[model samples]
Target: MTDESPAFPPPPPPMGAPAAPPAATPALPWYRRRWWKFPAWAWLTAAVVLIAAGAAGGAKKDEDNASADTTVESVADAATTDAPPTATDAPTTEAATTTTVAPTTTRATTTTRATTTTTTSPPTTAAPQPIVFSGRGDDVVNLPDTDLMVATISHSGRSNFVIWALGFDLQETDLLVNVIGGYSGRVPVNMNADTMSLQVEADGDWTI
Candidate 1:
């Protein structure tokens, strides 16, 4: 064996100086790379869900506002269109007043009538007079005659004088005497000297 190993010739220097290589191999086509694609599907689904939730919230707020507006409108209409009271439906104070007035008037009229009735009156009576006889001194002055006579006269000269009574044989009797030319009948005397005088005077007929 040769005592010293023969030195191998130095390795030949690397070809061209050591160079930076390309970054990576070419990616697979879209249809063929399957392992990491599930993450991409998950991101797309999350985005779609977020959009649907926002739309639903907006629709719910609009419905609530519309309902509140409808309630307010109904209240306003009720306030403006109420009905008024009618004549028959109101209280009856006037009827009471009318009834009271009628009764008062009737009472007053009745009182007046009663007062008038309380104030009236009545009548009276008369008297009586005495019977008498009268005559004038005239033509037939008789003496002891069987006939006895009595007379009456009217002062007004409107009617004839008449003898109202007579006596015969001293028994009194009624007799009629008729005379003319403003002369009453006669004056008489008896044998016993019972002389009688007669005359006519004014203020109605009287005996003396």
Candidate 2:
């Protein structure tokens, strides 16, 4: 009784002995377990956001380039339609020319002639000689030296056939002249007379 002293306390561990280990904590979920896991996830999320934004920006830039090309093509077409035409596109024409010439002429001429005149004269004639007459009776008369004679006689008688005779003596020959009683006209004779004489007779009274 008295000896049952209070349960004695356990004795102290000896020197150089290992201490007892602490009790282990319970295992958490995979997300909560590592301290660096949260920062790695945040970095991955930032990388994904950057890639999506870059793709969207690339698509928008391509759309803007297509619109610019279309606008340039429309401007070029309008400029071509408004320009003026060149010299080769216009029409061509030709002109005509003419020349004229005059003609020459010649004329003919004529010649003239002159007129002439003539004059004439008359012929010359010899003069005549006078004659001597004898009465009706027988008579003898001397004559001049001449070669030609003209004589006339007249008688008063009723007989139609009475003869009258006369004779002349030349130098070498004798010529006899005869007349009828009724003769009254003149007679002409030609003879050669060196010397000349005349004799007259009639049957009746005669005049010469």
Candidate 3:
């Protein structure tokens, strides 16, 4: 007998044997498979892309934050450098000047003058001259001297008449003389020592 495997194969797997697993469905490539299905490479590739994107974003954000920090620091430094300096107390200087004045002197001069005086002598007056006369008669008579005359009567004549005659003649000489006579007509007459001699005359028994 030729042992020929029965035509169709051994009897189909017994019903009890776990039915051959349903033919495994062919795995589709990642691009052609349903969206829910994924291969290891596909998941790995997606995970790598996401990780790279997150890293890139984080780097950009850090750079931005760094630039902001640099800008703030630069602004603060600039403000410090540009601020004005503080004031200090310093002393000021001043100059002093002096002036002088001169004094003036004056001199005075004196002058003297002389005066003259003249003395004059008083005028001399002439001396009086002496008078002399002699005569005798009973009637009135006259006796003459240099510039004077004397007259007398013995007949009781008024004395005024004798004085009038002497005064009238002697006025020019400016001399004084005195005479004496008797009380009644009969008595004799006499003359003062300083007088010119008196002349006498007799009229009847009386001397004039």
Candidate 4:
């Protein structure tokens, strides 16, 4: 016999086993693939992007609110603006009142019991310069000290009001006004005030 060995038949497969290999999983379409089958890192990245977008929107909303607040404050300031009420500011118009005294005249009587009549004239006096203060609404205006002052009040509105002229101790001076509507009048300030000011309660524009 030659040195070649004879081949035997293969052994039988295990009982109940299938003859073919298992089938491969079916592939999904491109659109449906990433819906639920995405990896852990991909889902985390998507969540991060959503959170960043929300934060950016919130920040923009806060900035818009701040800008609105600033606009409101600016409008409020303009509505109640007040003019300068310093005591030193004076009007440019000048008014001078001049008085002349005539010489005494002596006349002889023509009729009987002739007598000479002599008339004497009083001394002339000059009027003081006027200090003017003007503004709208209610305010306390400071004034410079003066030996004598005439307060000429002029109101444009028809509402009745009163003004109190305070002395250096904040007490009511002799000068005051009580009237209604648009009025133009003057009051002599008798009481002297080292620190003088006017307390006004009125409506509409006024000048003094």
Candidate 5:
């Protein structure tokens, strides 16, 4: 009279003891299964290294450019502020001049007579003419190669000379002509041809 419960497959192994279902295959993660995570870490490290190197290179380049700019600015300032004009900076041109002076000679005759003498020389140099160029140097030009002289002079006391010849001198020899470029001794230069006379002005040594 049975009505007894069916076996029901041994009650499904007691609801939790079914041998753990083969351990679920351990669920190998995306990184462990495909080995792609190793490459990804490598790529990330390489990217970081490249970024650091690029930054360092850029910094070095910027430093170099800054140094060069500073050098150029300093040079320009020195040239503008420190350097003054000198004689060797310009070309010399020939100027025409004439002079007549009367001198008194005393002889034993108890009477003095005034003797007049006429002299001619090149006109004294006037103030240095301003010439502009891009850079600093010495330049020469002319047909007879007179001089492209630049000089600086210094004088303390005043003298009673009429024409103070202050400039460089051109000394000629027998065989070859020597160029002595410097300040000359101050000498007197007078004129009687015309009323107005020309003279060279300098602040350095006056050459003969």
Candidate 6:
């Protein structure tokens, strides 16, 4: 027997000769390989379980996204819809204006009038003068023409006293007074007399 454990490497071939292959390692058995140690049924069940877990994870992600979108839509609707007004949104008003009125006073006026009196007197009138005619016995007297007048025929005699009148030519004649004792009476010398001549018959003086 030769020495089986040689410590030195193999010698190279000549410069032109092809190198020889390294020694081949011995192969392991199928049972000892890592890929074929378990049964086929275990692999088939594990593959099916892995596929199912992937599908379930995808479906759960989709459900979560849809729930989140629905919650966001609900929040948006609550924010945009109608609502009652608050105290801060109400309108403000100013205070009312105040006015004062003044009172008025009235005064009355009075008027006075003065009265005066005047005295008046009537004018003085003088008495008319008496006409005088005197005769002692029967006589004829021409009487002056006069206006309508009333005169007293006065005789101062105890015997008969007579007064008569005559016209211008002594044709018209009339008896005026015939008296016995002292006589004082009145007679009217009017238009019919016409200032005629008068005849007086007396025992004493006679005047008119």
Candidate No. with top lDDT: 6
Each prediction's Cα lDDT score?
0.46, 0.59, 0.47, 0.76, 0.42, 0.77
The 10 consecutive residues of candidate 2 with the worst lDDT sum are: 158-167
TM-score of 2: 0.33
lDDT of predicted model 6: 0.77
Colliding pairs, model 1: none
> Model 1: runs farther than 4 Å from truth?
1-38, 83-208
Candidate 1, residue 12: lDDT: 55
Compose the digit string of candidate 5's lDDT tens values, residues 50-151.
999999999999999999999999999999898776657567788978787889887775777889988889898897564322211222211122233322
In the order shown, what is each candidate's alpha-carbon RMSD? 32.3, 38.6, 33.6, 50.4, 51.1, 31.2
Clashes of 6: 0
Q: Which stretches of candidate 5 lie over 4 Å from their true place?
A: 1-38, 86-208
Top-TM-score structure, candidate number = 6
Please give, for residues 9-69, the per-residue lDDT of candidate 1 as tens digits. 3355578976555445556555555645657786788789999999999999999999999
43: Cα error in model 3, Å? 0.9
lDDT measured at residue 61 in model 1 versus the true structure, 0 to 100: 92
Alpha carbon deviation, residue 1, candidate 4 (Å) = 99
**Model 3, 200: alpha-carbon shift in Å?**
99
State TM-scores per candidate: 0.22, 0.33, 0.27, 0.36, 0.24, 0.38
Worst 10 residues of 3 by lDDT: 185-194
lDDT of 3 by residue, 1-208 (tens): 3322333443467876876654444454556556555667878999999999999999999999999999999999999999999888688777677777777777777776766777787888886553323233332234344442332333333332222122234322222222334333222222332233332333223332
C-alpha RMSD in Å of predicted model 1 compared with the true structure:
32.3
lDDT per residue, candidate 2, 67-107, as tens digits?
A: 99999999999999988877585575666777777676666
Q: What TM value does model 4 have?
A: 0.36
User: What's model 6's TM-score?
Assistant: 0.38
Question: lDDT, candidate 1, residue 193?
Answer: 30
lDDT for 89 (candidate 3): 68
Q: Which pairs of residues clash in candidate 4, taking residues 3 or more apart in a chain or in different chains? A: 158-181
